[model samples]
Structures are given as C-alpha cells and as structure tokens.
Target: MATDKPCKNLHRSPSPAQCMDHYGCIYENNHLITLLVDPENGRIADANRAACEFYGYSLRQFRQLLICDLAADPKSGVQEFVEKALPAGDEQSNRMFIDRHVLASGEPIDVEVHTGMMKMLGKNCVYTVIHDISERVSSEQRLRESEERYRDLVELCPEAILVYSGGIILFVNKQTERMFGNKKQELIGKRIEDFFNEVYFQSAEHNKLKTTGLLKERFRIEQRLIRRHDNRIFDLEISGVPVIYEEDKALQLVIRDITESKRELERAIRLQEHRHAVSFPLDSKAVLEKLYIPARTLSGDFFLFHKINEKQVIGIIGDVTGKGITAALNISALRVMFMDSLLSTQNPVQVLNDLNLKALQYLGEDYIAGCCFLFDFGTGLLKAAGAGINEFLYVPRGRDCERITVKGAPLGMFESSEFEEKSIPFESGDRFCFYSDGMELLFNSDELGRDYGYLIERFAGAALQDDCTWLGLNIQ
Candidate 1:
C-alpha cells in the first residue's frame, strides 16, 4: 500500500494537538502512514497507527525516533532536507522526495515521502506521508539495464542500423556512423533528405507509407545513397521494420553495403561478353574451322591457332581444371605463357614443357589439360604433344580418323612432368582434330553415353553437351 499523499487525508489522533484541527475528521486510520515532526530538531512529534505498524514499532517508540533515523543514508538526503527543506522565509512550503529507508528488521526499502508545513498546537511543524515504492523502483532499474544492453548490441553491430520516426532520425548505430561518415549526434533529429538524393528520398517515403498505412510489418529494397564526406554514391540493400520507439511509432532500418560486389558483377559480365565475342583471323590455306560452346557465362575451354612462321604454325586447345571466372583467368594466363614460349621455339614438347613449369609456379592447385600441335608446311610433317589431355585425332588423305596416343601428366602438378611428342608424315589432303575433354566427357544423349568410340563412328558429325572447343587443320 502506498501512502505518499497529503497528511490531511490521513486519520489523525486527537492527542497530537496541532494536527487535530487539520486532520480531526480523519481520527486515527490505518490506510496512510502519517507523521508529525518538529522541523527545527528533525524530531518525530507523533505517528499514526499505519506508521507504527509499517515501521514495526509502538506509538511511543515511533514518537521517540527522529525523521533522519528512518533513512538508510542519513547524511546524503535526510540531513540535507532537515537543513534546507524549510528554510526561513521560504514560500515553498511542500516538498516530496524519494529515499531508501531502514525497517525494524534492519532491511532497507525504497520510500517516497510527501512533506508539508503546518501549525500544530501554536507551534510550527511538518507533516510527513510515506509510500513504499520498492517494487516500482526495481522494475524501472531493470528496464534501464535492459535498455543499456540493447544500446550496446546496436552500437557493436556490423551492419548499419538506424531508427527513425516521421522520416526524422532518432538513433543510429556506430556502423551507421562510420558508413555515413557522421557522428550519431549529427544524424539524430535530421531527415533522410539531408543525406540521400531526391530519388532515394521519394523511395523511402513510399516504403514508409506502404508499411505504416498498409499495416505491413516489414519491407526491403535495394537503392543507392551518397556518402556524407565525399558525396560518393553507393549501392545498399535496406531492410525496414515497424517498431515502437520512445513510446512513438518508428521505423527500424538495416543497411548492407553492396557496392563492391555490384561492381565485380558488372566487370565479370564485361569480361564474359568479351571472351565470347572472340574473332580469329581467316586462314584460307590451313583450312582452319573452329567450334566453341561454353557451359556457362565464361568458358573453361580455350583454343589458340597462330602462324608462327612460314615454316611452322602452332595451334593448341586446352581446358582449365574448373569452369567460370577462375578457369577464364587461368586460360588468360595460359595464352600469355604460350605466346611467350612460341616466340623462340616451335617444338611442341618444349612449348608444353615451358607452360607446365609456369603453371606449377603460379596456378596453385588448379591444373590445365591441353594438347599442342606444330604443323610444318615446309616438310609436310606434323609434331604433336599432350599434357593431361585425351588423345588427338588424325585423318589421312584416304583413311579413317584415328586417335593418336600421347602421354603426359597434368600441368601444375609436378616439376618433373614430361610430355610425349609424336611426328606423323603429313600429306596434302590430311586433317587433324584437337579438342578438349568436354567433347568426349559431355553428355550427348542418354542412349549413348560419353564414349569417344562414338566419335570414330561419327567423325564427320557429332553433337556435344558440355563446353566444347575444337580446332581443325586441313593440310594444304
């Protein structure tokens, strides 16, 4: 029960002479703990029945105790009140205060004291009313602690977190501070219009109205906003939720930065298109016909055919260990290495050996399966080598295409890796096919599995499923 009300509302005993007139009709009740005290010496003149029961004391014992005796910290609050609560010529006659008080069992509890000046039996005195507020104060303290933890969590979050009401900022996390390059103080009470462009401002307004007006609980969007310091705009993925903050409806927003990822995606698109739109110079005499199909946006299959000199022309086809951008990067590295090696030597074995060493040095765990061919127009002899690749196809002037057996380990695997070289006497009307494993390993149809044996039956024409790169050279 709380009794921190006007003492006049409490029942007063007639024996307390001065209080009898003001509280005579009250006449001893237990609902309120009321007290009459001599203000000059902080002495308790009288206490009602409720006060005696509340303090676990008899009426006479209560009257013997001073007002300061009830306080746990007498010096901090009680002494100050006794000296200044009712100074001379003070028009402010009433005072209310909260303090911790000790009960009869020596246990402390929170209390609110309402005090007012009064004339009791022709002498100045103060009336006191007490209320127990321990439970209420404890609940408030717990709420404060919970709020502190919530604030810490928001401050330490990795993504930007913001709370706003009516498009006005209310709170911003540390990540939001760093992202916008502004302190939380600068953002609080500010509108989104200060940071975002007009387009984003309209979008935010639209989302808020859609969420609050339509009773939507949450919404998400991707947009761009400018940084505060440099005014550089970047992409953001924003997620918003409706919440009550500071007793007012508000919006909670979480922002994720996606500028770098978006840029990388655009760059990859450009690279993939560039790689797909490849153009090879026409070679009317070599009878070169190439076919390339990519399994993805970027192809793991790559082929290169260049005329090294009048006596020799080098052609190669390869498949990197994996697909997509990683394989594409490795293919680029292979092209650079192959071009560098071809500038000095035309031997298929030496060229492959050089590439193998470079692959081992730079390609890490990834490897390349490739076959190299050097055609000598001057001598009508074709030299061939392979590394981690399937057999090459050879067609004589009037003979069926046959697989040429070659031996080599995959590049980037070992330092002592070797490639086998074979020479075939070439005639004027001969054809050779060089292709990646995608051709044989690719699924053609469920009826016929990935068997290169089918290639011998349909050497003239065969369908491919996986990424395939093939280069054909007709001996001129």
Candidate 2:
C-alpha cells in the first residue's frame, strides 16, 4: 500500500511536486506483476496490465491473494515500515522502500514502493509499483534442493562413502564422518589429499584404483589416516570407485577400519613362518614329518607335537573350519591346548575333552577335523585316533596297508566330540601318512579350477613342515 504524507507546501503556493503524483515502475527491467498492496493484509488495491499478465491472471484475480501467502516469510517487515511513513511530513515520505508482494497464485514479486502525496479523486490512496521476482526465487529453490539432496544422501549411506573430485570432498556420509573423526559439513569442499598420508598420495595403486575403478581390480588398499585431534593414527582399507557426478567424472571412496585385522595378519605371518621352521631334523632313521599350505596367508591345518618317549613322539594334525584369520586364531588356540595334555592328561580321550572345553570357552561355533597319534618306542606301540579327519594311509614294507575311517564329527561341531586311539605294532620300514581334507576334494569338476584331489597327490610327499604338513613316518 502506498500512503501520502502531509502537504509541506504550507505557503498556499501551487508547488508542482505536490500537484502531480510522482511515481514510476519499481524496476526498469521488469514490468509484470505490478500491484499496489494494502498495507494491512498485503491485498492488491490495483494492478497494472503487466502485473496481470505476469501472474497468469487478470487484475481482478490478482486482487484476491495476500503478500504473506507467496513470500516464505509470513511476517514481512517491509509492509509495516511502509505504513509508518504515512503520518510523517511530505519531506520524510520522498524516499522509496523495497518490498516483496505475493500474487494470486502463490508467487512473490519484489517491489520498490515509493511514497508521496497522491491526489486520486482528491483522496489519499496508496499506489505501489511492483517488480516480478519469480525467476530469481525459482532458481534459488532449485539450487538449494539440488545441494540438499546430495548432502542428505551422503550422510545417510551406511558405507563410509565420499564424493571427491580433483582433491576436495564435495560430499561425505555419516559413516565417513565417524571414520574421519569430523563432521560432514566441516569436510565439504575440503581437500581430501590432506587426510591421506604422503605414501597413499604417491602410490601407483591409489591412482589405478581412483582412475580405473573396480575393473582395474585395485580398489582396496591399506592407507594411513591421521586424526586431527590427539594425533591418533588409524589404519584404513580404502576402496575408490570412479563415478559420474554433477556432469563430471569423479571418484567415490569407501574407507573401512582394518587396524585389528592388519595387526592380526602381521602376527600370523610371523608365527606361521616360525611354526614351519621349528621342526628341525634329528639323527633318528625313523621319524614322521607333516606339512601344510593354504592358498591364503593363513591356513586352518596345523599340527601339535609332543615327545611321548626317548625315541618316540605323539602328534595331532588339525584342520579347523574356514581358512582365514579367524580360523588361524582358533588353530593357534588349539595348538596351545594340545600341548597342555602333558600338564593335564596323557589320555587321547581326555585331550580331546579338554580341547572341547577350551573351544567352548573361546570359540563361537566353528568346527574342526583332527587326527591324533601317540607312539611308544619301548613297546613299539603306535596309537592313532580319527575325529572327522579322513584320508589317512599306513603303508607297510610287504605291500600291506591300512586307511583311517572317518569316525567322529568335527571338533567344535558338537560339544561332546571324543577320541579313541587304535594301536598298531610298528616294525622297521613302516610308514604313516596324515593329511587335511584338502587331500579330499575342493573345486568343482571344471578344467579351469583346481582339482583338490589332484593337488594333494602332487604335494603328498613334500618336505617336513616347509610349506604344508603331510606326515610320512618310516617306522623303524
């Protein structure tokens, strides 16, 4: 609403400024949606031809809406300030105030409201000049929603996802926020290179992973991520994949914490090497040796050794379910438990009972297959027990041989799996061979895949614990 101030030309002289209502278009560039709003509720008192055209309605239709309906802000201060200038003298009302006007169809039009003494049929009437701001508002809303959608999805994804282009992180997810120890908003537009160590930035693997994506098969790599606070260091398994983002090609990185697994692997590697080197050669003509090899860095198959007598030994070859770090840890625990038989009980049944007790204590639900053997030199008595383990061969000197039957289920498979040792007379030139299920079968019958039985045949007679253990005893 445009209001008029008191006539300051008190001398009764016909001043030209007071006689003529001085007004023009609010904005020179815009002509549509021009309307004079009533200051109380921002209703259109009058609308120009351009204002009617811009609103997609006639002047009569434009008069039905209020300014508050179109502008996001319901309490528009621009309207209140314009009404305040009406009581002042004409000198104070000479200036203009910019205001936003709401149209009939819920659209806001910006206006520069000029105030002056207006004589319309000899009565004071407020006439407001409006400028259509639809293009500006629509553009701003589109931009805001676009940015918000991306930002929200990034934070919501469970994966440690990040959107990085060139060097900066355009977006980061909630998991990534936790992993990096920073807020997603704080990381936006920040250089990702700063978070990575110099080695990662310098590595060829990083380049290949980022540039070529999964097809390159170089997605996962260990990297160092330093926390800004307290200088804490954490190991991260970083996987970068290439993506098309915002009309530009970019890289999305998923970082996983691999600190615990990495430490365990380093420990297992050293221990496996030590376990292989521990079996040194002796002067005895009759001795048994076993070896094991896993395709991965760790194997489930391992053996426990004990000196049963001055010239004889007792041992058990074990293969726990699975062949990664989890199985390796369980196998290590089993080895420690197997050696405690001397301190606890020498009975094969008791040894197995104690192992189950320990497995129940530490292990979850993983199972194991094992072959337990005890030898006595004084009586030349060789005792062997099978618990889920099969493919055991006893080759004698005169073409007589024996094979072990699968008797018991895998250890840890049941809470009460037991063992019973079977004795055999050991004459000179008798041999006993022990092995894991790898000797049984693994791959499907495809020419390209590994034939597990064929592999066992090729590696059955290998060295003593150099790689994998396949114990062959030439009993004398």
Candidate 3:
C-alpha cells in the first residue's frame, strides 16, 4: 500500500529529508548511488547521499548539473542518457546500460546504470541506480588476455595438438594441420577416426583408452595414422589429457610422429640380438648350459667361450656398468679383446689382467664386473678369477653345494688392482656354476643347491629388474 502525498513546498527542488518523505527512505538511504533526473532534459533534479559521496559532489552541486555531465563522453552521452530516461512502452520497466562515468577527481570508472521512468513530485522523472563494475571489468579483461596468450602458445607448439569430444574433432592447432597435411578448414569439425587407420582406431585397446579419456583419466598410446594427402601410414604416440572446451568436457591430445625413430629402434634391436647369439663348441666330456635374459632390447651382460683344446676351455662372463646400445657396443669390443687375450695366455688371472689394461685404455670411464675361468676336463681342475662378480656355486655329486668366492676389484677401477685366483680340483659328476650379479636376486646366500635347471625356471617366471646371465659346466 502506497500513498502519493504532495509535499508542503512543491515549487522548489526537494531536500534530502523532503525527498525521503515523498519517495520513502529507499531512494535517499540506499547504499547504491541513486539519482532523480528530469526525463526530457537529462537534468539531475536530486541525488541520494551515496551519489554525492561517490561522485564527490554535494546535493546542491548535483542539482545544478546535468546527468550527461557525469558521463566520460558528454557529447553522445547526452543523447544516450535522455533516450534511456524517456518512457517507452513500459515506463516501469528498467533498462540497464554499461558505460564509463567520470568522477569529480577526473578519474574514469566503469559503472552499470539501471534507469527507469517514474512519477516524482507530480512530474515524469528518471530514477537511475549506478553500480561500480571496475573490478569486474578489469578481471574480465585479464581473462581475455590470458586466453589469447594460451591460444598463441598452443599455435606455436612443436607437437600436433587436437581437442576432441564425442569422437569428433573440435579444435586442431597449427602443428596438427602441418603434420596431417591438411588446412585448418579441412581438419576442423572432422571425426578423429577419419585421420586414423581403420584397423588400429577400432582396436579394443584404443577404444578402452577413449573410454578412459572421457572419464577424465590421462592416457598415452601408440597409434597408426593415415596421411590425408599421401595416404601413407605413420606411427604416432598420442598422449591425452582431459580438458574443458566451450564449457563441455573434452580431451586434448598431443601427437608425436615416431616413424623414423621406430624404424631405427627395430634395426638396433635386431643388431643387438645378433651380437648376443652364442654358439657352443662340441665336447663329449664337458657339458655347458647357460641362460641369458635381457631387461631391455639391449643387455649389459656378455659371455664368450673359446676352446683351447679338447681337454681345456676358457670363458669369460661380464656385466658392463650401464645398459642399452652403449653397453652393447662395449660388449662387442670386449668380445674382440677376449679372443685376442686367449691367444696370449690360457691362465684365468693373466686373461683378466690383459683385459683390464685394454678396458682402461678403450672403455673410458665405464667399469666391468667380470669372471674369467679355465676348465680342464682331462686334469679335472677349474681355475677362476673374479672382478666385482666374486661368487660361484660348486655342487659335487651326492654332496651339498659349496660356495667359492674369488676376491678382486672391478676392472678399469685402479691401475694397481690385484686379482686373486682360486683353483678347485673337480671329480667326476661335479657341477660348476658362474653367474653375474643379477643372479643374486634368486639366491642371496652362498649355499645355492644342485638344481641349476630349477633356478633357471624360477628366473624365467620372476619379474626381473636387471640383466641376468648364468653359465654352468658339468663334469661327467
């Protein structure tokens, strides 16, 4: 219920108290800056206390000023202010406008103005409510600038990037266009399946990854893609991370071309497998059984055996300090040196001494854990020297296995390194086992029983973290 009561003095502009009695305290006491203006001329008739404080103007000064004078741009602001204040179809309907207003101190501030036509003091007047939005505008501007910077970074990225949702490609970076040999217009709004090979894209593993990616899980997979211009299939490593695009859940995929690298890796694997291949010599009195397992495509472990005579065989089993192609190349160099050393000496200690000198000269900073041994079947004796790999298992027929350790420093470690040689006389039905340090994962103690075959089976099934090598000799 409202009452429109005429004030005592209606001829002059109303004071704050008089305006409050006419329009209620809401217009004068409201925190938001409120103003009353003549709709026809955009002349400010009255203003609240908040408006006076916000604009640095007293109520008397505000009454003398025009509403257009408060706008940053006064020329067009005059027409704009008057046009909003004038009554249209619905006079009570509020119209909102965002504009810049100048304060008394000459500082421009962004403001949201809500204007409506209303009857005040028996005349059609405009009621204006102003809300300062400078902070919100500043934040929005910073957000836009940040988005522009992120878009620039994405465009300059080296790897192909794509944003996809529901199997359809929503966005593609410049690198993606160059990699797929397609233009921006050609790739956008296309299905991701269209660019990928049909057989691989539809695979169960690939579908599983797609499902996982949609669930916001990060995933990586190797896929084959068909080039649109050439129709040539190429390998691609696609790493996907969940992202939001246009307010919808999507996936961003980083794709790398790995065709050349994959081919080079395959060639290296074949070469390493050939380098590790061993051919045993034919001997009736001695039986040699070995197991070699690599943790990767290339192994650090290497073994070489040369027959000195029908009665004697000399061998060396070594593990380099590192793995991969470098270790494989070191193993090849050591193999050639081992063969040359056999020509000079048949003694285990002298062979290691010669190899150590060569390793110091050629192997650079790398060290080797090695065990060299000479077995004589006719004399029934085994002589072995160790460098880093010091333990050996000796199992005699119908007796418990004995642990034999030959102490020596690792090769290429010191110039004055001394090696100890252990000579054990063997009888008929005795077994000697020599292994690299990786074999310690199976048996930590010195007592490793007679069954070498069972240990090999267990090693085959066990999860191995390093390269392992085992060589066994049986005297029959």
TM-scores of all predicted structures: 0.49, 0.51, 0.72
> Model 1: which ten-residue window has the lowest total lDDT?
443-452
Per-residue CA lDDT of model 3 for 1-476, tens digit only, reads 99999977777886867785866677777898999888767789999999999999999999899888998986766567766655354676888888899999999999999988787657887889999999999999999999999999999999999887777778899999888777878888887667655667787656744442444678888877786557887888888888888998888889999887667556655765675576555357667777776663345787888888888888888888765656767787888888988889989999889888988998889998899988887888999999988978888888877889999988888777888899999987888888888787567544244456776666666557777877777777
By TM-score, who's the top model here? 3
Residue 301, model 3: Cα distance from true site in angstroms? 4.9
Flag the better candidate by TM-score, 1 or 2: 2
- Deviation from native of the Cα of residue 446 in model 3, angstroms: 12
Q: Tell me the deviation in Å of residue 35 in model 2.
A: 19
Q: Best candidate per lDDT, number?
A: 3
RMSD values for the candidates in order, in angstroms, are 12.9, 14.1, 6.6
Sorted by TM-score, highest first, which candidate order results?
3, 2, 1
Q: 62-119 in candidate 2: lDDT tens per residue? A: 6776644445457755455555435443423645655565555676566555644444
**Per-residue lDDT for 28 in model 1?**
58
Cα error, residue 182 of model 2, in Å, equals: 12
- Better model by lDDT, 1 or 2? 1
